[model samples]
Target chain A: MKPETKTTSFDLAFYDRMAAVLNAWKHLGEIPLDKIPPHGMMEEITRLLYLESRLIDQRRLREWLDLFAADGAYWIPADVDYRDPRRTIAWEFNDRRRLEERVERLETGQAYSQIPPTRTVHLLSNIEGMLADDGLLHVLCNFHIPAQRGQDHQARSGWCGYIFRKENKHWKIVLKRVNLFDADQPQSNLSFTL
Target chain B: MTTYSDHLPSLDHQPYQHLFKPGFVHRRLYIDEDIFQQELLYLYGRTWLYIAHESEIANPNDFITRRVGGRPLIISRHATGSIHAFFNRCTHRGAIVCREPRGNTKGFICGYHAWTFNITGECTSVPLRQGYGKSFNLAQASLQPVARLESYRGFIFASYSKDVPSLTEHLGAAARLIDQWLDRGEKEPVVVQNGAMPFLVNANWKTIYDNAGDGYHPPFSHESMLKVFSNRYGDVDMNYYGSDFDKSPMYSKNLGNGHTFLDQRPEMHKLSAWKRQHVMPGYEVMENALIEKYGEAHALPMLDASTGSGMNLNIFPNLLIIGNQIQMPEPLAANKTLLTWFATSREGVPEEINAIRMRMQEDFPSFGEVDDSANFEACQEGMASIPEMAWIDIRRHQDTKVGALDPADQLWREPMSSDLHMRTYWQRWQELMNAGATRALVEAGVA
Candidate 1:
């Protein structure tokens, strides 16, 4: 596919729109207590998360990138309560184009940091789901990932909040935010997708 | 308190003088525990060390706690708009006073003993005054301030020694360079956006410092970034260091003291071409406005230069001003270092420009920094294996007759790949370490 040369202006109004979208995700209001998704829908959400985790573990970055909507964003904030990506530093904030570039870099064997590719296994549990007012499924889960490079091993635990939209019987990720417990701590090289 | 030199292994003139030659530095300088301790003392203790940017603590009673030169410090801005740096430890029992990394508070109260102090380091109250004797002095119980504090363009620096040279004198020509860069924006101050992005590497602190001013490693070490740039910008020369080094208008400058920077002004223009091709959302509008305001000839170059393609400045010991980030390395141990990168933006610049700065910052830490870290760890591991090969050569440009007197002389110009900057860095290190030994002997009256 040919890459799009057109670029969107990141002006004040663009930031305002992003802020509203992020705020809406933050204050989803606990599934309304009575509006929780049925057990089958919860199971389906869990199955989708498991499939996504497997794709990341398998290092199928191109396939994983295809699972996201065109306007989807993958955000890993330095702060758990982070709202604005423009004003502060974040661990990972990638639009679709950035994500594609990242995959391209990884595919090139010249990416020195990933020359000896890191192997990761993601363990996810406590899956919860609700149908939000915007007709999107809000799924939350806790994950513990054990990644290894040569003899070095590291365990990272985080809470993943995802917004998935149903399109033609398939679920597409609209947003994914992972809040790690030690997000602010000094980390080693995080070259691969979390 | 005992002097820093007294506790370390003797660094007297004997074997110390042989450790470093003109272009070769001993490997032990990086791995020796005794030398590391001495550096924490004579070098870091006596120098003007960068602590925090003033913008981090802009409001009254705003404070950020940081470890500067292996000591915990609380840098606070008082209600009067004055900044103060104090030891984070309490006077009562030496427990940490503030636990939060950053916050705004009128005063700090010790959780252990309830010893309260205001933002100015004045002890405001102490629990149970009657328990102490009648001569108990509240005045003596105040938080201990650092010996001296000074700021240049909102970059705060503190020194443990009051008698050291003034901060401006210490900075010298480097200060002028920094001022020129900061003043390039509109008259408004440069703001450091967000807190730091901290990373830990299994390498000595000096390893990180050495890499900051290094130009030779980029072409080889960051092959991936080069490939990406090559593919994106079809005109980009992939041979960054081969034949391009001869044509590239880039050189390394030792800007007095131990500070040095790489002048890559011409190469920056080449990289800025990518911006024009894949322009940001409102680049055309901004470009047209700039052209109308300043005329086409001037505005075009101005826009190109605004991408920060001039220099990569490294102030010795800690601070590194590269691209749009201020990176500082804190030494934790002989083989452990904490690296923090802070994104900086001009306060009065267009929001889109700042957004572009943020996008540029993503190129590092993820790819470029990870590549450097791999080399740092590999260098440390290599030194461990070959302890007998004590000297590492930094003699690339040593024979060049580039005396420090003339700034305009072509003799002073060396390719960006030269090791002149590292040689100058080690020369300063040897001088300061030798000065410590000389001072010790003079105090003992043996000289």
Candidate 2:
């Protein structure tokens, strides 16, 4: 039988509606480093970073979501050099809405990859922070997470870069990008937040 | 009674052939080292293994290093505009000539001895050549190329044996479906995007291949993903496979020469692909731009192109095209497999459309593949641990005579959730494996 290519006017409306809802993903590393944050400001930013890691480890996802600004994003690039989300694929690229969906899925207890749940201990180090001219604080830190699931224990080592913005007397993450050392290599199933 | 063992002492085809029954296969096929080695020689060595896409090395002198069938290869586009595949090993002292994974370069210089070879695998320069005898010829020192290389519709494939059937003959009826997929490009070239999402699964390559066309697993395996799709977006196009998915009209076909596909077009045609998707980052503005430029009629199909072609096409041994992604499962070992999903985009489409395509492509590998990998690992563990359960029963729909054959193409259509696809491939596998190493894959006029 011959394959047919049929077109309909109603099908056209779907594209229009979908395009209207789709947003362009931004590269988190686009901020320019102009100056260093004050010593106290760095300490405060470090405290917030520590709190974020702790929240994830404790499985307090809802609380962790609160640490992000309304327009925050969580990104894990497929490669360290891949800065353009438009052309490159990412392991995880979540906007606030997507992040909320991810949290909801995990909480449903049906996300089979995390059925028994992955127990993780994130160790953060080499923390440094700088302030952009626009009052955005960019922080860079090395991280090593020892995650265990069932009979398997995997040690994931990576460095994280974060952009923080202060809103109404609170520090919130605008973007968090994780760059694994073996970013381009074939990775095992990474279902949990890194 | 034949026994399946982890430490099988022989590689003889006679004893292993006894392990495959009519409706079941021995579990040792997934865990035994000797059988795995034999498979490498008999199946992968004889089949047309996918190597690289034409878009990957679109420009001359561009190259990528890949390990197909456990053999390290350098697929490069020569200055002469012809593509070439050669062993990645150096002619001198056996060191890897090119260390980098992929890049465009004039020539590759071996770090050990500074011996250089051009992109086309020609030995251009050799340091301290005078010290060697004049009998040592530069022409003879060129890298070794594979026995055969061929591509169809921008998909490149290579084989270490020249005795196999022609690529067109091997593709058989599957070519029509691949063309059906390519037609979405609207005559524009379908470009494989740069970044690849490759994940390691602790399972046999065939374990993943078996699941590729099995419509029975998705509702259970990807229940979470389906649930999220339903809760967030009402009635997504591809997410309709719920408890009653078996009753759906989708058909799984066994294309000849071990090729198979799970056709989701029946459901996909019910709705435009774009209308069924979860909302993306910047929808409104892009929608208006697309509608204004292409007009409503043209924009709809373009949106459909952004999602999958609604067909999960699996070419024998490797190569799977599902959604907007191209997957190739490279078997590292009997129990270790590395699956790489290459996201694809249309050449002439708008950046926003391709960008949205990229995001939608990540949905499966990140969410759905996680569960699939977990199951693969679990299946491997179970097979390795349970020696008593010697056979894996693949007998579903065995008695159902509800199949139609397209005599022109020799295509066989079966129920979506039937085991016919697996059985057909296994029957082909037994034919190849039992044929031993010396016989031609297709004799005289049989192909």
Candidate 3:
């Protein structure tokens, strides 16, 4: 006889929520017409995105940390389209505390993975932003980041989704999710943020 | 300090036998194409390769596609509640049948020709019947099964060799170690959850295995992480590898047949493993909730289980169990290896318990593993770029021995940093290669 379906605290609703964001990101044009942000807001959102990449590339990591809200999360799922952080093992799922530790680790100079240090250039496109049902600004874009560490070079291309909340008159990332095209495939050291 | 054995390719008729000796492994073992092929056949092909956790396919019709010894395989649970492993290759034209990584299905239909096979691997339907004469036997066209499939606890293993030892025999006393790991489930099932963090290293698979039980590298290889833990969390016992580390009660033991494990229980049991970990997002809330639900007495132990198993168990050739995670390294080529880590959860735990487990599980793979891959790749590069460095030294604490109290037959206990595990496993590897030499010679018509 088949075993009874086991139940745990893992909420399927989280998967449903993340899946909705992914579906919406994939078909941005199908988003409700009223949800689209104003053109100026879109331009501002794009500029914020560019600045985020610039801060990371310039190694202004402390400044980059300031771009997130106090409860911010940085997630890189092992699978691209579907993820339940509570159930699946993600490549990265960092709350603010973990992100702080990550930055501290990288700055320690002894993080051998980044000892020679990784040089990265991010090219972002297909930018879109909307005021979602959750009253948060949901921004989506595609990115191609070429990173080199010593002689090893990698081209990391992926789609990024950001759930932004206005905090203290500035846009702060509540959630920054990176979905790499080869998320399901094996990866070398991804010691840097995308 | 170059020994004559370092430069010698072989001591006798066996081509690769001389490459290994007590306390040393020749660098050629890592980079030689000829040696890699033989290793795939003699070592990986013949041994019990871990394919899946039975928890993954707990129900009938559940299947997941995986690679065993670099060959594609599908491990499925049939309707009779029995598990069977089949080569994913179709009987017609040799195309892979299943494309998805995992799913529960009534049956698998090859997208190539719509050839269908049941969950038990029977050839159920071929598009048009009577296309050929009676020469096309229906039973003959069924999926090819692996020679042997067996499981202990919830771990499933498959071997291609018909004459290999039983899985129980292969595991030896190491089976008891596995039991210790499984006991954490507390009568509830321990499941290998859906997602995994798979990282590839440009290094020989042996390099990865050598480092598994070597407690010497963490202080240097992961210096930053340890520093962060101390600075941020003030947990000096997080790693137990700091000052007086050698004095710490932790030890690495070599279980016979290349199986080995690092016992950190002595050190970890001093305080709860959960209290030692760097605090994360839901730590306080989850800890309190677990305490409230299971009460302080029962909840503390469960929290420790969630924090970590505190044991790093390495089953020879492929499987490495660290804490609650199962690590399987798939050797793709001489220098390309993919290591996949599956985080696990217990069947009866609260959602908060598993949630905390997931968050804590992200610690090593996300941070520490990157440094490991870096070293592995660097080791590969150095070995390949400079052939003159013929010996990959594993001589540290090599002279350490088993005490009178210890079981002398297969068990060897040493300080945490001893290279005894490497020495033990390489001995088994050499024995396999030597035995396989006759088969290799016969296959090549050299005999």
> Which candidate ranks first by DockQ, i.e. highest?
1
Candidates sorted on lDDT, descending: 3, 2, 1
Model 1 DockQ class: acceptable
What TM-score would each prediction reach against the true structure? 0.89, 0.89, 0.92
Global fold similarity of model 2 (TM-score): 0.89
Q: How does chain B of model 2 score on TM-score?
A: 0.91
lDDT of 1: 0.75
Which stretches in model 2 have alpha-carbon errors above 4 Å? A1-34, B1-15, B130-132, B283-285, B292-295, B406-410, B437-447
Instruction: Give lDDT for model 2.
Output: 0.79
Task: Report the lDDT of model 1 for residue A144.
Answer: 96
Model 3: docking quality category: acceptable
Model 2 lDDT per residue over B127-245, tens place: 99998888889988898888889999999999887657778877877898889888874656788855899989999998998998887888788778778767777677656786466
TM-score for the first chain in candidate 3 comes to 0.87
Clashes of each: 2, 11, 1
| Candidate 1: residue B98 lDDT (0-100) | 95
Residue pairs clashing, model 3: A9-B351
